[model samples]
Target: MSAGVVTRLSTLDRFLPVWILAAMLLGLGAGHVIPGLGAAIDAVQVDGISLPIALGLLIMMYPVLAKVRYDRLDTVTRDRRLLLPSLLLNWVIGPALMFALAWLLLPDLPAYRTGLIIVGLARCIAMVIIWNDLACGDREAAAVLVAVNSVFQVIAFGALGWFYLSVLPGWLGLPQADLAVSGWAIARSVLIFLGIPLLAGYLSRRLGERARGRDWYEARFLPRVGPLALYGLLFTIVVLFALQGAQITGRPLDVARIALPLLAYFALMWTGSFALGRGLGLSYERTTTLAFTAAGNNFELAIAVAIATFGVTSAQALAGVVGPLIEVPALVALVYAALGARRLFSPHVSGSDRVRQA
Candidate 1:
């Protein structure tokens, strides 16, 4: 709220929660007021994903990825302290925690519970990048962690889905659900969502630096394009909510029921991950990266899998739809939380501090 902080953030960055809330409300209003809005938006699909949503994600992600110091990626990969903890938190602790929360919170609502578990299994490969960047997390470190997650996502997602939705539930004497997901579909989603923006960002960084030098690219080009990331995010939120606004409004109680576990999951995962990172003696940037990556989920993939396996009208799919509705606002608040928590890591200057000092 200080002028110093206000000056440090772009108008879009400063009022991010406001913009996101308006976008969500706009999408919901438009969806409710305008007939066939969902159909119109849903008409154009890229392998079952809405084209507009896909474009928003690509735009949201590219600039942040472009800002990564790719040359320093080797150093990030070599840091076992960061890499190993990230892997464990994302793959092991994250899913397990979600599974427990979903079952514990939604015991009677099996379909929603299954959907939340599917959400849990899908570790973040996309929006976490934007959140990480917004929170002033390490760019190189985030890029590496994201890439690692994408690989694990392609390899482990279905297996984990089975383990959680079917295996583990069965072991516990709970009613089990089957997740009939295609490996190729999962692979394709990862390729399209992560692969495309990653390629664009890499090329943009590489060529921009080569042509204009690192100083020009970082100082001049990045700021110009950086705001686009948030623009894309807002657009995506509007479209995402619009696509399901009618259902969301009609089933307010159901949406609230599904939202409870998700709220708990994000809060717990982010706080725990941040604490773990600090306990491991990581810097603020890497710590933020670890926390965001661990806390975020691939909702796009979760929705697609849920729709593909269960009908779009199914409770499972509705649970997937509720994901970003809760996530966008919750994580935006956490961005501020991460910023405030930076003071706890004092004597350890943050990316925002470096920019302010510069």
Candidate 2:
């Protein structure tokens, strides 16, 4: 890539989250004043699914998947310590904590609380890449983690859904849970969202490798797709937030309440995973990469499933939508924090050290 292209890519990487948040606010404001705009946009459904929103998410997930180096799966699998922490944080600890927080804080709003759990359970799909890059993480390891998480999510979503409804309530001091999420519905959503993008990305990569050189593929195609993916994600967030603008205005405090647990979750996961990776004697990059992989959530999939399982008007779906609103900004901050802390921990000679030693 040319210096200018590389510079532009870096700039976009820095500010994409800000742009997403701006799009969401702008869309929400417009939807509120325009009254029926959100409804009309949301009404553009196909086969009982929101076509525009779904397309946006699909487009958003494409770039992340496109970067997956499937051949490196063996290398990642060999790192059992990294994989174990990721599984525990994402599947065991993350989901459990989210359920407890949702139930405790949103006692009266079952749908919203349920939506939060759904989002948490879905795990990281896209933003992990951005965070991993920001933290200067192991690129190959991050790619393999993404692929593994995608595969596991498809297989475990149904079982997780069942556990969320059947088992989570008792642990949280709540009454019997009665949420009805069909296994088939979870399976279909996973297949349509996660499976399609993964296959498409894999096929595209394979074809690009055959047709064009790796240099051309990375420099020409990958760079182009990265920003497009972020744009697509932001656009979807805009539409979803717009659709629920009125509710957000009415329950502004609700955002704060939900954000508390999310913040806690992020901090705990990031710290725990980072410490674990460090104790295992992994490099700084691998540690941060694994930390972010464990910390981020695939909110897009969560929102999609929430809307499908519970009506778009339901607070559950709205809660799922709200996650990205808080997370985009929070994660951006975490990205910078991770990057800034690198010099302090990295064994590689710091620039200042080199200058002083010189």
Best by lDDT: 1
CA RMSD of each candidate after superposition: 1.8, 5.4
Model 2 Cα shift for residue 231 (angstroms): 2.0
Off by over 4 Å in 1: 1-7, 349-358
Tens digit per residue, CA lDDT, model 1, 1-358: 3355546766678888899999999999999999999999999896687899999999999988888888778888888989999999999999999999998999999999999999998999889998887778898898899999999999999899889988888899989899999999989988888999999999998999899999999888988888889899989999999999999999999999999999999999999999999999998889999999999999999999999999889999999999999999999999888877877775655343335212
Among all candidates shown, the one with the greatest TM-score: 1
Q: How many clashes show up per model?
A: 0, 2
| Reference-based TM-score of each model | 0.96, 0.83
lDDT of 2 by residue, 1-358 (tens): 2233224335656565678678878877977899798788878987556787778778877776777666666777898878877778778888887877777777777766788888778888666765675445776687677767877887787678778877756766666544555556555665666677878888878899889977787668876776666777777778877877887777888777777777877877787888878788777777788888888998867777777677766777778777877777777777666665655464763111111000
**How does candidate 1 fare on TM-score?**
0.96
Worst 10 residues of 1 by lDDT: 349-358
